[model samples]
Target: MRHAETVTFGGSALNRAAELRGDKADVLALNENSRSIALWRGKPLICGTNLDQLALLPVSQDLFSEADEPPVPPIFLGQSEDGSALFAHDISAWEPAALDTAAMQQFVDPTQQHHPALPDDHRFVELRGVMAQLSARDAELAATARSIFGWHRSHRFCSNCGAESRMAMSGWQRNCPTCKTSHFPRTDPVVIMLITRGNKVLMGRSPGWPDGMYSLLAGFVEPGETLEAAVRREVYEEAGIRVGAVSYLSSQPWPFPSSLMFGCAGEALNEDITVDPHEIEDALWISREDMLTVFSGQHPTMKPSRKGAIAHFLLRNWLADRLD
Candidate 1:
């Protein structure tokens, strides 16, 4: 947790410039004047690509192509120290391609694509590789794009007035035509923790995860609940572990449909795990050494957490004695 900001995407100190969101003229001018820029789905975009993922897109193409092409909302990622534009694309429009594992696999497997234009640094490729090879920033960008775009597609109607809303503020907000209400993009807070007692850490596998894959216990923070309380409640509700002394570790923007995962390391007061059949298929405590084996691919029944996820980062640092 101490070296959290040093963690891949977690460390890129890009200037998000939240204060400038309202300055429409200056933003438009900056986008037009930016030297090194990337176009996502046609809106000008920027992001501090500390890792070379931004160059993965096949030559810059207008994000909004074709007369009938749907709108692609562009998010202002941030600016580099040299003032270069850093941006991200909402490829959630291409979600169907990602959800279809077969199609997604083809994009990553270099030998399979008949005419692959995507770069190796692309999120789709790095996701398929072994852990630690992919930078956390790239993963964050991909996830952000997917989640935000997915939100736009799903929340086209205003909840307050049942009227259609339009994309505004560079995909960061939506404005309802009927009630004149402004809705901002949402990142649901989720608590993902490594519940440890002695040398064993608690992990669980969801019903849909690939076979042998297990991760830290996690759940969304309910309305009006504090983060610490959410961590305690989630650990107990999902794994039946009574947690005490919850400590925040790190946070990651998980774009898998718009979520912000808050990583934590908590002290477990109880060892007995009564798995919630609805929340998790199975749960167990794995020793530190066993976790190392899992990380090294020596464990046959379990696969480590997804590379770009905060769970994987937390577990890796925890194993490396760097999470203290």
Candidate 2:
């Protein structure tokens, strides 16, 4: 696919400066630079009514003034074209959430709400809701910020010695004071399969998704499993359909707490679907013609995957016969 790299959060080469991460003086100097981007909560500071897109704020922006609480140390995202440093600072501690049942949804679009605490010129919005509209560069930066900060939030204590760990390597690692063990950020691997038989593709939906919402069958790759094996296993486990030939398609960096989604195309050898209640709520085979309707939002019962996600990307390319 011509737009493979253009997928959200995967295209830009951030040129992550690993060596500078351990250098305290250099990392501190980079944080003081004017070009850094600050991420508050899960949202990156954006300029204007462009809720569909992200506009990074300068490190010197007044938005940092409201960040009174101590944030997890900034991560060195990498360098831009002119050798200017790009960093992601977490101000999540300053942003409080009023959780409700509505917050149960995995993805939220905050473009509709005006954050009263933020400056009038900028609003921090959820990236998943606006990823399709963001430029490849913006998406990549936002993903990096969310993933790194999320890791820090969950791994505050050492697993080895049960001691509190401190951030090190410019937010790339955590070091235990007691055991001196180091822990790095983790990216969970998942296989999202586009399983096909003749002219139809298999899709399924979890219990609580929006009405008519369906997506490619996906599951986490287990220990001692290859991507292909995971795809075949996930299909059979979820839909009870046997898969034969599985091949790689494209990949997307999904930063909902950091996971790498591997898209794959699989040829199904059997059509009968015995939906596993434990894995899937419903499973069905939709013909190509019906899929076109879903993509166009004209289908009566089925809706396409969320835009900018690997499922949507793979399905779109498959519809156009461009998955190579």
Q: TM-score, each model?
A: 0.78, 0.91
**Residue-pair clashes per candidate:** 8, 0
lDDT of 1 by residue, 1-324 (tens): 577765444565556655555455235434544422233331113222333343433113443232124735455555556664445444334322223446444423322111123343323333233213444554444455556666777899998999999987666789998899998888899999978899989999888676788999899999999889999998888888899998888887655557778888899998999988987899999999999999999898998777766788888888888877
1-324 in candidate 2: lDDT tens per residue? 566786778877777767667685244544555365666666776655666456555655554545655534567777778767777766655634543336634546444333465567666667777788887888888888889888888889999989999998877889998999999999999999999999999999998888888999999999999999999999999999999999888889999989999988999999999998999899999999999999999998887789999999889888999987
User: What's the C-alpha lDDT at position 186 in model 2?
Assistant: 95
User: CA lDDT of each candidate?
Assistant: 0.65, 0.80
Candidate 1 clash pair list: 9-137, 41-63, 42-63, 45-87, 46-86, 46-87, 47-86, 47-87
How far off is residue 294 in model 2, in Å? 0.8
Question: lDDT, candidate 2, residue 12?
Answer: 79
